[model samples]
Structures are given as structure tokens and as C-alpha cells.
Target: MSSLLDLHPMTRRSLLGGLAATGALVVLHPFAARAASNQAHLRLMETTDIHVNLMPYDYYADKPNDTLGLSRTASLIDGIRAEATNSMLIDNGDLLQGSPMGDYMAYKKGMKAGDLHPVMKAMNVLGYDCGTLGNHEFNYGLDFMFNTLAAAKHPIVCANLTKGQLASDPKNDELFFKPFVIIEKKIKDGAGHESPVKVGFIGFVPPQIMVWDAKNLEGKAQTRDIVEAARAWVPVMKEQGADIVIALSHSGIDAKGPSEKMENASLYLAGVEGIDAIFTGHQHLVFPGPKTWDGMQGVDAVKGTLMGKPAVMAGFWGSHMGLIDLLLEKDGKSWKIVDFTSEARPIYHRDEAKKIIADTKDKPEVVAAVQEEHEATLAYVRTPVGKTSAPLYSYFALVADDPSVQIVSNAQLWYIKDMLKETQYKDYPVLSAAAPFKAGGRGGADYYTDVPAGDIAIKNVSDLYLYPNTVQAVLITGAQVKNWLEMSAGMFNQIKPGSKDADLLNLDFPSYNYDVIDGVTYEIDLSEPAKYDKDGKEANPQANRIKNLSFNGKPIDPQQKFVVVTNNYRAGGGGKFPEIAGDKVIFVGPDTNRDVIVRYIISQGTINPSADGNWRFAALPGTTAVFQTGPKGRPFASKVIGAKIEDAGDGTEGFAKYRLIL
Candidate 1:
């Protein structure tokens, strides 16, 4: 490794000047001795939003995945450490809750005090310097979270998360964890002067945690604003003899202006004074990329900087490892960042033939650290719960109301009816709202859920429902339900009334927002413009895309109220639908949606998977639209009702093209 003390910029410049003045060569021994003491390189390694992917094995699929897992990332970390003179590893949160392995650990294995969580054990084996908690860490409640954190060898910091109702006031609310940690690292300057650099790390989570995990957090804990927390803590860290400060922000970058409740506030957090560099995640996106930070002000995408300060966000699920290399120069008694570079290393990539292949070889030590948990998780997810009469897949979920979504709706309704019995809301009619989570967009063609007709295992339920969202009931008027459906209908591109073979299925619309509301029959008109824009703004006031909305055999009364059972994300304004969020919630169930599905399957013994044909596209003569989906859906394309679908050819990103005859 090249030491900073090997060469001094000024000494080398003076020597050249002296040589230029005199023809004869002149060497200054004193200048040469002081040359190597003036410069040093500091590397900051980060892993963000891992979501408990400790091993390469996918518990949900009951198979191995090359694209995910910290074991694979460990090899990359080892290689980087070998190349760098000085480096420190820090995880940027969301480490505890996403995969079925995490679910298995929390629900099945159960983490007791002093017990090591598989993720913590693996991270300990890898020797993490410090870590911060992401919003998902609170998904299993505080007790489980604290028990898991107890096993972590490194310090866990979170400045924003606090206890009690005084969360907004940081002074009054006691911090749930250490606000920040000052890590002392040794480095040599250009003059070969050795000194300790106190790198302060302060962490922040999204304030929206108070809303998303309301049931688990209410009256117990709350989260403060990210920017506000950083602004307050950075100054404190500076006063505590910290040479440099790094903001380990669990929030993502979304907007230029910072709000108290904004989910993506990393841009604003970076602007905080005294913060030298930043680590960002929670959007599951890559920074320093043209597509994500395109045209954004105060950002240098090529150099990976936010507000001219070094920053990086590794892709989620252990797909990438973020690295920030800082060129430090001594400023009197402390060190300041003179220059820096940031990049993320991926674990897998696609070849010319489009075959996904692993790049980083897995570290056996990391794999061995959690081998027992890995085997148990595999066993837990593979256990069969029930049998299905027909295949359950989501390839045609967005194009039509398929059996996959119908099963979710049926399970929610069945669970909610019993829970709401003998209550005041029991007298009102019940409805169910569900959306396809795996329709193959950014996740690629193989991401679609395809469960063959046979024994349904716990892993299949995890595949069916990717998120760990709890069930919640929202009470809304019939008019609001129609508005909700209209927002969902925006998934289709508007086609001219008589235009031939127009494009359908808006590529920008997320499949998770295209909800299918059960217990109501509706038809979407492709001829009209969308009522609302993708941001939920009223784009066209007079547009009427939703037609023939009826409940049972009669037309729905706009004033009549109905209770819709859906996941907490939808009920908490995740999709930004019209008049469906904020104060409309009537009940919040304690069980997760996955658990509900599991219980429903166990109760039924054998599930009859079939769509009720409650929704269809309105007739548009002489007009058609082309769509794309997974090629696996071609066999069942003819069996789907409401629209004519024909195989076209191969589509972009390994998907199959399909022509929707409207």
C-alpha cells in the first residue's frame, strides 16, 4: 500500500523549482524526510438496507439466489479491505425485516434476550464498526428489536427514534438508542505524523415510521424528523471532539425541500453543516447513477455527491456494497475532507445472453456463522400448509383479476368478518382491496409469483405477500371507493376511441398500486384520460374512466358507507389515493397479512383458487392495446376472461410481449 507519507505535494514542487533554477541536481534530505507525513487515505465501507439476507439462500423460494445475501457481500468487503490502507465497515440499517428468513426468526424461532439474531451473528463475524436502525427494524415490536440489538457487538446508533409522545421535541423525548458514536481511527499524514481521527457517525430514520408502524409504536415510541435530528446532533458531535462527521441516513433522496414527515430526506440531511460525508438507503436505489439522480440540483452523479459532499447508497438486499474513499488533509488539530470518491459494488450481473450470474464469491465464514438458522428457515418455509385446486400466479394480475389476488382478498375478508363481528361496523357491508406485489417490473421477468397446483407451503405465502404489512380496515363512502378505483384505473394508458392497436398498461404505474377491490363490480373505459395523475393530482376533472361501478346486483349508492379490509401500507396513504387515507381507518388488526393467509389456508384445508369476474374492461370497438408480461403466463392467456390476449414476441428486460385486444 502507498503511504501518504511517501510524497509531499509542496516538497516535490519545491524540488522541481530548485532543479529548474540550477542545471545540477540538488536533493534536500530534510525536505525528503518530511515529505511522507502530509497525506492519508481513509475508506468508509457501508452495507445498507440488507433486510436480513444473511445467506445467499432464499427462504421464500426454498432455493439459493446469487443476487442477494451478505455472505456474498462479505467477500467483496474482504477484497476491498485488503486493497485499502485503512477502512471501516458500517451498516446503514433496514437489516432486520424483509425476507421470510427474518419472518421465520421473529415468529418461529423467537429471539430471546442474549440470543444472537442470524443477521447480527453474521455481521459480528464480518466485524462491523457500527450500524443504524432502519424503519423496518420496528416491524416486530420493541422487545424483539431490542433483544436482537443486544446481540450486536458493534454500537447501534439512531438519533431520531425516541420514546413517548414528546417525539417531536427531541429535548423532552429520551433517545431510544445512542444518538451517535465517535470512532477513533489512526492514519499517517504527508509528514509521517501519526494521529487519531475521530469519525462521528449519526443515524436517522424516516419520521413516517410513526404512521406506518403506528400500532407497534403508539404510546411507546416515535420518530423525529431526519433533517431536524441531524441538524441538532451534528453540532453536538462537533463539540464532542469529533474530527469528521458522517451522516448514516436511513432515508432516501426524493425532494429538494425537506419536510417534517418526508420519507426521502437524505438530500436535506446532507446539507447539514459539519457533516463531511453521508450514507443513504431506504429507497432501494443506487446513487451516482444517471437515472436516479438525473437533472437533480446540487448533486454530482458521476462523483456521487449530495450538495457537493460525498455520499452513496448501496442497492438493497445485499446486492451491492457502498464505498466512500476520503482524501484527508490536516487542518490544525483536526482533519477535514479535502477530496473523496464513492462507488457501489454489486454481487451479480447479467451477461450478453441475459443470464444472471454471481460476481462476488460467497465467504464461507459468513455462511457458516448462520448455517443453523439457514437450515431451520428452509425447513420452516418448506412445510406445507394446505393444497390448492389450481395454479396461483400473478403474471396476468394487472391485466385481469387473476386467482392470485382473489385469494388475498378472500383471506382478508374471511379474517376481518370474524374480527369485526358484534362491533358497530359489523352492520355495514364489507369489501376487500388487494394489489399484485409481484407483477414483474423492476424485479425482472422471473420475479412473478408462480405457485403450481399442489401442496401450498409457507414459502408460497411469503412469495404471495412480499411485505410484512398488517391488515387494517378503512371506512369510506361509496363515492370514495369509486375514486379509489379510478386512481387504480390510471394503470392503463389512454387509448383513442377508435384507434387501432394502441399501447396499454402504463409502464410507469407500479403494480402494487393497481388494486383490485372485491365485493364490487366495475368496468374501466380506456377511451378517457386518467382522472388522476401518477402523483394523485387531478389531471382531468371531467374524465370518467371508471364506469358501471355496482355492488351485488344494484348500483352503488354514493352516500352509503362500506368498510374495506386491506394492508396497513394502503390504509396509511402509501399509494396516495383520493380520500382513502388519514382518519378513515376503523380497525387495525394485530396479525400480518402473511399470517392471515396462512391461517386461512389451514382453516380451508383445500383452497379453490378462482377469480369472481367482478371487474373487466369496458368495450372499445376497433381499439386495442399492446402489453407485456412474463412468458409463463402464455399457457393460461386463453383461459383469462374479459380481454383477448395473444402472444406477440419477446419484450424488454426478458419479458414476453402480449397484445391486449380491447
Candidate 2:
């Protein structure tokens, strides 16, 4: 039902007389001059999951492009705002620490009072009204976040953050962002009088910040759950006499449990009353359109309302700006939206001559500021990181004791073994677990780091180790450790022994959480159903997807204790890996996982690494397979080099296929 309801004011009558009378004059009728005067249509704009892409601005590239900069988005914002009567721009978190700009600020550039963080600088030029906190904000700790946020002209709203034992306290909040803001504005009426509307906005972040950013916020502060916190605060928002309520969620949309499990947080939150519209991020996705997950009803394509309300999660980086237009019907003292449409505004559109021009005029000031930082960071992004003789690749991660994980584990164990020399668990066998982060998903082909044949530079290093996560080792029994792999095996759907083109895998599963234990050997039996416990417990250990679990040709003894090295998040149950939780954590290493890998590379001085028979795709004989995978993966056939891959041509950027190996 998308329609062209309104036309340019001048074009209303076709003004046939103008076309007939003024030959060249009517050719350049600006789109802005078309709308009515009482155009109080609120344009709710969003920048979701912008993981520090300041350049294009890609922190990964360390250069500037016309595509992603808030500068580019600013062009679209101007056009949309000019067409609307009123508007509000918001960022949905994960904004602070993903790119090299953030890395430069943290390690090289360093932050100080009044120092303009590039992303914040761009936001300042756009004049964003408010934003919510994404998990990445705490990566560098509270001081940097506090100082940078203080520099922004907008309000940062997050409700679940705790200050003291009570929900309200001076010490418990983010210390800068307000929990919510009630914005009031006037709209012109047909009588030439002003009418008032009150817009209530509140923000929430995923409660798991405690696990993911423990390096930043463990004993320093506490955060409550997103839903529980909203329940406690949204009522207060209503009591304040606010009209429309919106949630700026750093969390993603949710569907029913079982298949989705922890995935459907938004749907659960939507079930919460009074939440009029939800602007979601974190798991960056496009919603309410043609996209839908497997085996869900309304989700095959969500309607404008969930639990009777509008919700949207725009695509990530500066790719698109989510624009939701709601038509409100005035009812007595309150106004309820009668209908609505949500879409992302492209940064460019076809002009009269069919040339893709700026969606609107690019804002010169914002572009200049962002471009300046973009260039400075570009110079700093790709410098020499360290040398490695070993090659690190994820080709065999699912099957064997990999050298990449071995290097990381060795580094973690080496770093911690001495520090815990006096501890009782120091006598146990130590192993390290690490997952591949950048593997050609949304990052494109070059995203895969093959620092081949020579010195590894800083640019390639960023590709290999994207995040600045610290190392951590947890204590677990040999049995519990075995169960942990069973959970990871869930990443693969059950590929039948002789099935064709069935993905039997969940490629969308993030590799950061996909920990592979380099100290053990096991095989995934594509023929069997996976046994799993939803509550993070070993409720059903007999699930048979993983077979032949052993070490040195002997079954792993359940009573044997092992010191498992991993990133801090997994040691704290980030992926709900069975038997691994914060309480079982033994040693927290000083160096980050990225630092450990980098340091390991530097230590080796010339690391020769490869898949080297660590793991393999269980041999399938004479079967043709087909299943859907992602878009970026399409161009690189090595992603499915050994299989009969279909072009699919969808550019989904995920990997799932039915296969028959002769």
C-alpha cells in the first residue's frame, strides 16, 4: 500500500497553463515546495548499530567514502526534514567503539576534556535530539563515555542503568544520559493557530552489558534487564502526561522462543503495553518489509504493529536512515496513530535526468568535520601491527584443534600461568578458545585477513582481530567442556548424512561467540540431532550431533579438570555455552584477546598458520546439496569451494547449502 498521496503544490493542477505557457521555467520545481503548510508530520529517524564507522566512514578502511558518513546521511535528513513539518533524529547505540576512529581515540589519539570524538562531532553538526546507549559504549570504560557524551548537544537516554541499590540514585545511572525525555512542540492548524503535541521517548540497552563489557563495568556499576526496567519506568512516563511513547532500544526485535530463544527480545518487549513504537538496533536488521525468518507467522513479514504498536530496525552502519511516518487521529485529549509506514531513506535518488544525486544537498559543515577525522584516522588505521609466521584462518574451526585458537590459548595461558603460579588451579591442563570475527559477512571479501607471505600490517590486523576484547580463562570439568562444544555445534542445522543443499547450519551466528577449543578433538555427526539445553544447563547431554569426542585417542575423562582460556564474555556465558559461566571463571588475563593474538604474532616473529587438518567438513559421498547463504559470500567461491554452490544471486551474505560430494 505505498502510494503517492501528495504532489508538489505547483504541480497540483498540472497547471497545464504553465507547461503550455512557460517552456523552460517549470523544469526545476523543487520537491520541498510541494507540501501543505500544516505539515506537522513527525519524521522519526534512526542510525542503528553504527559500530564506529566514522569515515565512509568505515573505521575498518581508515578512509572516507561518500556512502556511510553521518555526513552522507545528513543529506537525506535535510530533504526529509524539509518535506515534513516536524522531525526528530535518534541514534540506536553500538555507535561508539567499533571502528579505528574509536581505536585511535582509545589507544593512540587518547581522550581528554573537549576532545571531539569523530562520531560525536558529526552528530553535533546534525543536531541529533537524543540517543540510547549500545553495549559497545562501555568498551573503553566510564570515563571516556562520560567525557565524550558531555560534549554532545543531545540527550542520552537509558532507563535500565542502576545508580545505587534503588532504581533512582545519583550513583547508578550512566551519569550523563537521562532515562527519558518529554519533547513538546507546536504544529500549525488550518485556522492559523498553533496546536501542541507531547512526544515521550525512553531508551533501553541489553542487560548483558555486565557480561560483554566486564572489562569496563563489573564492580563499578549495575544494570537491570531491559523489559523489567521498562515496566518500572514507562508508567512514570505516562504519569507525566506524555502523549506518544517511543523506545530507543539498543536491543533487537524478538520473536517467540525455542527457535529464536534469546533472539526475540523486541517481540517480548513489544508485548509490554504503552510502548507505541520501537526503534531497535544491536542485531542490525530491516523489519516490516519483505524479509522474514524461517517458520514464523507474522514474522514472515511483520505488520506495522507488534502487540498493536509500530516497530522497526533499520540496516546498520550509515547504509540507511529508518524513517517511520505515523498518521495520528486526534481523539478527545489524546492522539493515537491511525496508520503508518516505515522505510529507510536512501542517501541518493534518481534526479530528473536519472542521475543519482544527493538525497538532498549534502551538509557542508558535517561533511567537512567528518571528512577531517576520517582522513586523520585513515593515516593511523593501517600502520604495521606486528609480524606473524603462522597463518590464521577459520576454515577448520568447526572440526579440529586449530592453530589460531592454539596461538590465542597459548598466549592466554602463557600470560596467566605466571600470574596464577600460587593458585591451586595452576596445576591443571590449560586450553584456549577463540572464534573468527571478520569472515566476509557484511564486511565483503577483503574483510577476510590473509596477511600472507610477509610482515602483518595494522590494517590486516584490524581485519583479523576487530574488537578489543580481553583474555579470560575459566575452570571446567572435562565433561562440561565437552558439552560446551555441543552448544556451538548448534550453529549447524542438522545436515542429513546424504542430504542435498540443506544448510543444516545457522551462518548468522556471530563468530565472536563461536569459541573453538584448540586443545581437544571432536567430529560433528551431520547425521544426528543436536542435544541442547535452553537454560544453559546440561539438561540433555545425550544429544548425539557431536561424535567421537576424544583427546590423544582417549575419551575425555569427566573428572579431569581443565583450565579453558577464552574471551571474558564467553567465560561469563555470552553465548550460553553449557557449563561455562562467570562463576566458573578462574583467571582474568591482563591483555585483551586481540592483544594476545597480536602479541603472539609478534612473539612468533614469523608465524606459519593454516587449517592443517585441525577440522574438516565430515566427508559426504556422491550427494548434491543446496541451501541458502549470504550475499558477500557469493563472490568468493572458496566459501563453498568444495561444494556445489548455487549463485542464488540474492547476496544474502550467509552460508547454508545442500551438498553432495562425490
Candidate 3:
């Protein structure tokens, strides 16, 4: 383990001043009076949702990106450590599986007993004190996850993950990893006297992992509810002499009160006793910032607290580092927190011209740790698979039908139709549902998928299907299908009649949740409010946004049955879509959606991926709307099939605004 002084030379000066102020030298002189205070400052830093972004590069775009990478965040670690007397760096999970580098490691390189995963190698260089498990860590299966974690130099803990069946009592369950770890450190108080402080770290992963990665975890593992596990184990930590406890919640902050297996339970977990602070993630959002979680009940965004407990959530892909500064005073036999501050510090920021500017350079040691694997991942993603006749992009996916989503829907329909040919469902009408994974929201303007008319590579296919979910076919009636589409219509905000330049998209809704079902033509009525809210709950039972629904130029009958091809996540209820669940699933394919897409592209030597104008927004005279997209989407504005797009101007956060004529 590297000492704070060794990592940053300036920390020595800062430590001396901090120790003198704390009264650490009182023992050296018996006659000297004790210093004024016995308080010590401890800084806790975190990196969450790294997703194997060790280098400052985007594998899908095959270019350098200044906004991401742990190497860039590592550059700030030394400077941050220098500002504190005692500091501990930890990770808040989602470190494994997101980029092409993770795929190259899991599917190609393969981990062995002693082989260090590229992410672990890079993280080990920074000396993470501890880390928790994120839902993405289980994407590659348990064998690979455990093997990769075996090489981590620091302790990794998760209280909710269990092996086999869950026991009635959360404490009696067979835990897969240590529930918590108490790190003992020597600290100097105001009198320059060395004293011991026991800092406890407990971690919780979202229980939704069982549904998201059902193929990998069913029958082999189970998960307890996050708050239940925290409530059960936090007291044990205190009983074991843990003076201060920090919860590494790999969950998002939701204002909704506690429920069974809630995906976002950080707000509820913060209310648990004995937890001094919290490090939150799994939403890929930043706290103490104005983007998300602002104005939500129980969330103090300005103070970075949940239920009055200090908390921090770093943005995804190493975009920001979550920081928590604590002022601790020794209270007889135990230490208690007196005051605290929290922040999510970014590695880069946008300039006045909306150009990304990096705040720090990449750390040489962290980059060197994963250089070999980084090069191999580049080679792996660059391998050509097939060619496309037209360009594929998702810049206008939210406002119109898109080729990027069209290609995926076409591939899924092609594969599922052939798959059901020999089965009993062969005669059933087949439809495919697909969504744009990247639509330039919280991921930033450069995050949109843009592939030119040329050869398609593995990277492009991976960009189209961002998850490792397998293909699934669900059986449903026409009425249920309409309800499904109704749920997806929540992506847009309701526009009033005759309203000019109204905001089109519902920014709160995630792009991945906006499913576009193919093989059926329909129009989204913007004049009506969405029947469902973002959580799939019925917000307006009387609302109807879907209109002119037809299967083959005829109105779909309510009793008619159809098989919808989708990914395992949706079929298994990963997203809270109505009438879609495991019971409706008729077939679960063995291959991943990404693999199916690759195969589909290869089989069709050359393909033309163009939107067929199947779905469009209902025309409303005297009503116009506007939305923002990547600046690079200007040239392809005419390609959008449904609406008339006009240049509005430059938008905030490097996005270009466009007006939609309805």
C-alpha cells in the first residue's frame, strides 16, 4: 500500500500542519498543555461505474475522449490526497462490463486463476481501500466475475449477494462475499498523539441483478433486499467495534419509500442507524449537481445528503470522482462525525464554446497497467464483420424513427422469424422491439451512435446493442401490445394544442426504456398525455397516445395474438413495462443480442439499414416542438423520416437544438 506522503510530496507539509493543530506533540513534552482540539479530518474518495474505462478513449468511436477514463481521474487523486491529513480511496462498483474492452476480456482474452483483469490492474495502481459489486459485474457470469475479482489487491464486499436460496433471516443467508470490512488506521489528533480509528465499509448491490442477468444467476444465486441487508448487518458492525460506518450503496437515490427488492434504495438506506455516510451509484448520475435528483423529496442536492446523511454519487465511466470530507472527534471510546461535506468532482468540463476541456492529464502508472489489453481491445473491436449501404446513427432516435434502431429491429425480426419456423408459434404474427441505447442525454452530446456508410465492425454492433442480454420472444394479444406501446410513449412530454416551440422529449425518461416495436405501424399522438409514467405506473388511465395501430394494413384485433421479439431484460421485467414478464416469454435464445446482430450482419454480405417510416407523430397544425441532439447530426437532419426538422440553434451542454414541425 502506498502512503499518502509517498503518493504526494506536498501531503507531508499538509500533514505536519494538520498534526500540529490537532495536538499530536503533547506526549513529547510532559509540561506542554494539550492542543485546543482533538479533531481529525478524514477525506473519503470514490470512483463508481468505471465500466472498464481505464484509458481516455472511446472504443466504439475509435478515438480519444477527454471526458472519461480512470487514468484522468487518477491524475487528480494525488492533488486531492495532499489537501487532507488522512484520506482513503474506495470504489462504488460497476467497474466490470460496459465497454468493448470488457467484452474483449470476458469473451476473448479470458481470465485465469492469477490473471489480473485490466480494470483490477488499473485500480490496484490507485490503491483502492475497498469496493462493492455493481449489477454489471455479474454480466459475464459468476465464474468470470469471481476469477477477475480474485486478483483485486483490496477487499471487495457486498451484503446482499447470496449463494443458493436466501434464508428467512438476512443474517443467516449464505453470503457470497464479506458483508463488511473494518479498516483500522492510525491517526494523529490535535496533540500529535497517535490513536487508532476503526472505519467500517459495508456495500449493497441492487437486487434487480437477478432479473437483468437471469440466465447467469438463476438457481445458482439469489439476492436479499438492499435495505434489509443493511439493517441486518450495520448493527453487527457496530457491535464488532466499528467506530464509524460508511455505506457503499451500489444503488440510486429514489424518493419512493422502501419496498421489496427496490432498485434504487439509497434514500431508504441512508435512514438506517449507524451509517455515518454513503457513496451512491448505479444510476450513472452525479449528486450535488443540478442534472438529476434535484428537487426530489428527501434529497438535499445542494448539500449532497439523503435523509440528512452526507452522500455522493460519481458520474459514470470515470467522468467524476465522489468526494466526502468528514470532521471526526474522539468521543471517549468511540469516534463520532461532527461535520461533513460532499461533492462529485469532474475530470473535465466544457468551455464557454461548448468544447470539452480536460482538467488533468492521464496518470502514467495507471495507463501503463492496462496498455497491453487496451491495444488488444482496439484490435478486437476494429475487426470488420460486414458493410452497410446507408449511414447508421441515433441522433434523431427520440424525435423520429432511426436507422440505428431500425437495423437492430430488422436483425431481431429476421432472427426470430427463422427461430420460430419449426415451432408451434411459426404461424403467429411476429414483431420486433428495439430502442436506441445512446440518444445524447446524460451521456453528453458526443455519446450518440454515428456509423458512416461503410464496413461495419464489432464496435458498431456493440454500440447498437449496449447490453449482453439474450434474445427473447414474448406471446401477447393485440390489446396488450397497444398497452405496451402506450407505456413506451412516456418518453415524450404532452404538448398542448396550438403550443409553439414546446419541449418535445421527457428528459426524465431514459432512452433505453423507449422501446420501438416494428412490424406494426402507428402514430404517437402528442396532444394526449402518456398513459404511463416513467416507472410504468398508470399516470392517466383515460389517456391514449397510440393511434392508427395496424399489423398488415388492417386494425389489429384485440383477440389476435402476436409474438414480440425482444431482449431478456425487458421480457424478464428489467424495465417496469406493463404486460411484459417472464410468464409471457415463449422462447429464450442462447446467443446474446449483440452476437445475433453480428451474425445477421455477416449473413447479409451487404445491408441497407433505412427506417421504413412505419411510425410517425400525428400531424398537429399550428403546433411545433423542439429537441436537442449532437451537433454532428446537422448533416443528417433530412434523413429523419417522420417530421420536418429545422435548425433552431446551438443548445446547452454542446448540443444542437432543432425545431420539429408537427
Write model 3 residue lDDT over 420-467, tens digit each, in one string: 876689899999999999889999999988889989897788578766
TM-score of 3: 0.68
TM-scores for all candidates: the values are 0.69, 0.62, 0.68
Cα lDDT over the full model 3: 0.84
Report the error of model 1 at residue 509, Å: 15
lDDT of each: 0.81, 0.60, 0.84
What is the TM-score ranking, best to worst?
Answer: 1, 3, 2
lDDT of 1 by residue, 587-654 (tens): 76645688689778978989977888899999887777787788888898987867688888998888
Residue runs of model 1 more than 4 Å from their true location after superposition: 1-36, 167-172, 190-193, 385-401, 409-455, 462-519, 523-547, 551-610, 616-662
Error of 3 at 509 (Å): 19
Candidate 2, overall lDDT?
0.60
At residue 636, candidate 2 shows an lDDT of: 36
Worst lDDT 10-window in candidate 3: 1-10
What TM-score would candidate 2 get against the native?
A: 0.62
